[model samples]
Target chain A: MLQVIRNSLYFGGVAALSDVSFSVERGEIFALIGPNGAGKTSMLNCISGLYHLSAGRIVFDGKDITRLPAYKRAELGIARAFQNIELFKHMTVLENLMLGRHVRMKSGVLAGGIYWGKAQKEEVEHRYAVEEIIDFLEIEHVRNMPVGTLAYGLQKRVEVGRALALEPKLLLLDEPMAGMNSEEKEDMARFILDIHEERETTIVLIEHDMGVVMELSQHVAVLDFGMLIGFGTPEEIQANPKVIQAYLGEESLLEVQG
Target chain B: MTAVQSPFAIGCGDFRVNYTQDMAIYKNVRVRRRVIFLVILFFLFPILAPEYYVSLATMAGIASIGAIGLNILTGFTGQISLGVGAFLGVGGYASALLTTRLGIPFWFALPLSGIFTAGIGALFGIPSLRLKGLYLAMATLAAQVIIYFLFNHWDALTGGTGGLVVQRPSLAGFSLDSEMSYYYLMLVILILTALFTLNLFRSRVGRALVAVRDRDLAAEVMGIDLFKYKIIAFAVSSFFIGVSGSLMGHYTLVITPENYGTQISIEYLAMILIGGLGSVMGSIYGAAFITLLPVVLRELMTAVREVFPNLESIFIGIKEIIFGGIIIIFLIYESEGLAKMWRNLKDYIKLWPFSY
Candidate 1:
């Protein structure tokens, strides 16, 4: 489990995230949901080491990882899929997945230079890992296909598969179902649940889809204007007046009852 | 338990084979046999071919070495370098100086020159930390200009504008002064360098380079040091080019500043662009085509002049037009270069009887 403390992030002397705190439990699905500019992404960026904390610290599995670089965070069993789908366009799906196993690979330049003994063995082993992930994602057919040529939904799945190949303990899905259709969104939500249950990976998802978030996440945190308005179980978040006001306008709530 | 019958299964899971076996480079018995056959043919060609063809092959081999290196840095890394000739010149002039001026043997001078030039390349690459795209390319162009001036102005060290004559490398009391000897020498080294470079792509460093090329931010997020790897790519690329330069110097038995001009860099760029970027095989095909084009043109010109005496005046104009046309055609039609065309042709032939 990682503890994300009450953190404030300053952007150009303006508060991007002010006094926000949340903890992602071990092997559980956590959701951050709010309206536009709720600073949900800023909070994710802080945890991922993309943004420096102006105050407070992030302790991952009992180790303070606040100052670590983004890559260092990835190395420490944290992997993220971008909201915009940051797949390597020119590379094949297999090659993109193989890159995920790069951190797990131990061979240095000397072994690679000669391509003898252990390096070859290790490379073969890593290739198997990639193949397994490809199969798991049901993307075996498109293994050789360049990611740029794949559909947007498939590309997003491929990106998730790539991050999964890293074998991270904590997986961050930034708007994993943002632009997906109903069927695609259902498939993605199922995949996310499968990953959490099968791999025992703690997942933190940022999503605008309230129905999917309410259905999937065990813990939910609602933010409004870079501030945490509500944090608790899905049931608690659904019933909170503040959460309702953040989603539906205060005037609209009274009009609904009338 | 019943066996899995899916045609798309990873592989035939026999006792001795797996998915790795199915995707192997030397897959199956037939491929291994073909590879051995090809190796024999490659080794035997130089011995059987004529002296002029051997000379042309040698030029292709040397140029291929430089092209492969440039392909790695510019093509794979997406750095758009314009100072390949500068690096080549550094290697050639340094080796020439070490041998002719310092009284060192050519054998020692060759490798040392490569390292020396690589160091100079790293210095030039330092500017990359600040500049990018056209600005970065212009910075490298500036480096080429500076080196050209140094080669011209450094009178005592570089023999001024007169240039320096290089004594041929000797191995085990055998002087490699003859064209045949030089061809075989370059062929051996060229093969080794090419194979080394191919193996490089299979390594973690190579993957990191590709990652950086695709997305530097993502690469950094994956624990790869962007600046460190970029420099390493530059150093390795420069080293290969430098080695090729040493071979070029030994092959020609002369080192000149003019050989390392901006035009030469453009030719190197054109070779990779026309051949295919980031492809080792493309480098070979490109180098061979570019190197032999002039010779073929001269021969055609000679034949035309013999047949039609009036065509002599128009030769220069025709050559320029054809040269420009070829480049434009390749750019427009074959953006993936000859390698992709060759692959399609190969697939067509492989399934010829079936006619897919």
Candidate 2:
């Protein structure tokens, strides 16, 4: 459950997002679709607490999380998979996933330094959880390899697995299937579906592929410039003239009118 | 990521059976045995060696502690500091003052000095949240200059460059005044510090710090509080550095600002750089190597002076050049430091006859 009310973002007097309002029910894959610079990523960044909005409030799981720090939002089960694959490059995939378990872990420096009793147990427990994610993503083969050395598709999968490692309530995925092949994209789509169905995790996804967006997302919101131009069920959104006009050329819409 | 295996081999000998085994610090039976053997050898070294060698080892041990501390900040957390010298001074001065003024026992004074220096180090580290790379390095350089100035000019507190004389500590009526006794003490402390550091990198806190170093933005989104961990790194690093300073002060029975100059800070940086930036054992190796270098160079200079009477001054200049050149060479070719070299050597031996 997440709601954004009249969110506005400005950068040096230029609006990145303006009055973009939308809400997602507790267990749905909501898609944010737009052309280049439609502020989909910016909106996700604001929700994840990376970027601060100039004039708006974001209410997540019934709490106003507009002012909470990024880490605090993560603690509240909002995890994100970056479009550009921002996994810790030098660390092994297992270590990167363990880093996702960082907030949940409570071992202090002393206990960690000792590493004989509770800290060891804590680590093993988190390792088991991380292993589950690795299994889910089928990354067991390269689990010990540094994330930076992995192929692009594996890195994207690890990004998703990292977000899943947080056991997040609301996961934000930005261009998860971008630059992926058709087979890889299909695998990612299936993984996203399984994550939604099996875990009941709410997802806010930003994607470029229109067919995948229509097939996977229950609700779709189209943005053009900084404004939310359309919001409805996937079928309704596909039929909406505004959504087509925003995505296709303005000349196409004008030619139709003529 | 799998290593090439020999065709004649039946199976890989170092297979871990479980997650616990996989993540175990000692790794395998052989490694555990080697660690025990090394521990025994270190314990026996000072007993067999002469007093001069013992003293060198003691100094190297103390330097190892300080280098490991600096590595935690610069190498692990990716926060470069030029203020290690000042932080060490804070510890030395803090312990010196505590023991002389308050009449505290040496044991209590050591930890107190660490905490005091940690406070100062954390204060310096606040700038790191907003600054990075060379900019953060400059801020810490300011800390070095400012703290050294206080140590130099502060008349009543720091003795105004005259330096303070410290007393050797004893444990349960047994005096640590002798070089051998002090060497044993230094060795024990060094082992503890190494153990703590090694154990640290195997745990959650260590991974978080490394994550911060590699990708702070991603680390932050992963729910790691970047500033909190950075400050913690500063405090923890300074704590050990302070302890090392306290040990050094007591060993020599002197506390002087001259010992903790900016040049000394650069030397500490050199220790970690030459050892291995992020490896704990590399810090120890670098410290020992750097510590013995001047002694070896001096021995060489004296040997050459006997043959060529007028060449002593040039040798002094050459020693400096040699030291600078070694660091430059490490930066160019062996930047991973001795730790990686050690690893490569071990892997070579293990994979011999078909090492690939």
Candidate 3:
């Protein structure tokens, strides 16, 4: 459903990502694993159109989305939950989720201001959809609370809920389980599984937690120093010498065999 | 959507069943009735009050329109604008030029002037995509200076320092020439502006504006076009300010460069600050307070001067100091502004006798 063909991104004098290529089949949870500064987020940013690619192309659902704006990417069934929670802090969780459905809303300024006719109906419909996300994420308690006031784990859930509110065909979760407790990580893994299975959403997740990554992802791509060193199933990636070397120190190669 | 019953309810319980009921302007029938009563009282005030107070009401109403406009840009959209005075001038001049030069009717010129100001405001808003907060404010400040300069120097069009004369509007052959008639006109427009602004928050564009304000980057990633919304904010805000300016010009029968200088822009900013940011009702409260402050201060100063003739000159200077001082106090003690204070007071009253 999504293909990143030899995508490269540069920032100033440095190449954040270099010739990284990957493809995810539809309705699969794809994991991008890497150590600190391994270009996982950069790859997601490129695919989401937050950063312009220095080279190559991205095809999503058969369209070349290489030059599309971030919002255009969002409109084309792509949604992202940032590595750091990018939810609107001053807004309620519900408001943040409602804003996630912005591309679907059709009300212009004048019609929105009047808000008694078509605009009102659209708002209600979107609100209902947002409520389902709130329920699905079990964030009904914090639905009316401003996102800033929520705990980090709950805030991450809210961020995921916001992306889900898009009813996205492809959801990009950057470090969804980062900074989360074991219980929160488990819950997030479960939710990601549910989203993949029930909602049939194609998810590209960037996670540092190797355990969660191994358990949840159908396919795994490992990056080290802006290079995709391994791309395979969890079992294959675990046994790959390059993946093991990139993660464990070079001296720990014997430890991997042990 | 079952209505939950409150145990020992002190205030009215919200029994909203559907989205419409939940999002209703008033929470309940009682609140709606109370609002209607308040509106009725507002319309009746000019009839019962003295002519001077009626004139003050008209000015307050006009200021409210401009304040709401400023609030939409600065308060809701998080775009700090110091060019409100310029936008108002653009409207006033546009209306004046349209009526005087083009021989258009007052009714026609008024809306056209709003459109003209909106165009200018949108033009000024382009830099906001790259700039934020104080930088954007400085850009708008530049707009104020440029527009003000045009009003002063554009002799062939704006009549320069001599100013331009405006005729009161005649609607359906009934002239709105009297102060009472003009007050009614301003009051009606103020209500419509309030309603439109209030309803705006319930819909997509309003949420988008607030989202842009809260986090523009997040809004962008959520598929909200930041530039489009920001320009829309500027255009909508300037439209209201323009309409108010046109109304003011017609009411005063004159449009001058001095009327829409930087000081007036600061005053409009003060109105939203003191009233409340991101609140339609707060804009009205702030406008009324700021608009009436000078008159009230003058009265107070005159009364004090009568008692202490030696300190008469100091009282004249004290008004400006007190104005600055009050805003400072509000900023320090009640940064949420009068709307939050008013909400607290209402909550206090609701929980009266218990005093919690």
Instruction: Specify the highest-DockQ model's number.
Output: 2
> Each candidate's TM vs. the true structure?
0.91, 0.96, 0.96
User: Least lDDT summed over 10 consecutive residues: which range in candidate 3 chain A?
Assistant: A249-258
Worst 10 residues of 1 chain B by lDDT: B8-17
Quote model 1's TM-score for chain B: 0.91
Q: How do these models rank on lDDT, best leading?
A: 2, 3, 1
Per-residue lDDT over A169-251 for candidate 2, one digit per residue giving the tens place of the 0 to 100 score: 99999999999999999999999999999999999999999999999999998888999999999899877778778767677
- Pairs of residues clashing in candidate 2: none
RMSD of each: 4.4, 3.1, 2.6
Model 1 error, position A91 (Å): 1.9
Model 3 CA lDDT for position A117? 75
lDDT of 3 by residue, B170-270 (tens): 98999988778899999899999989998887688888999999877778888988999999999999999999999889988899999999999999999
True contacts kept of 2: 0.85
lDDT of 3 at B235: 94
Give the poorly placed runs of model 1, Cα more than 4 Å off. Answer: A5-15, A52-57, A255-258, B1-16, B19-23, B26-32, B101-105, B317-321, B353-356
Q: How many residue pairs clash in each candidate?
A: 1, 0, 0
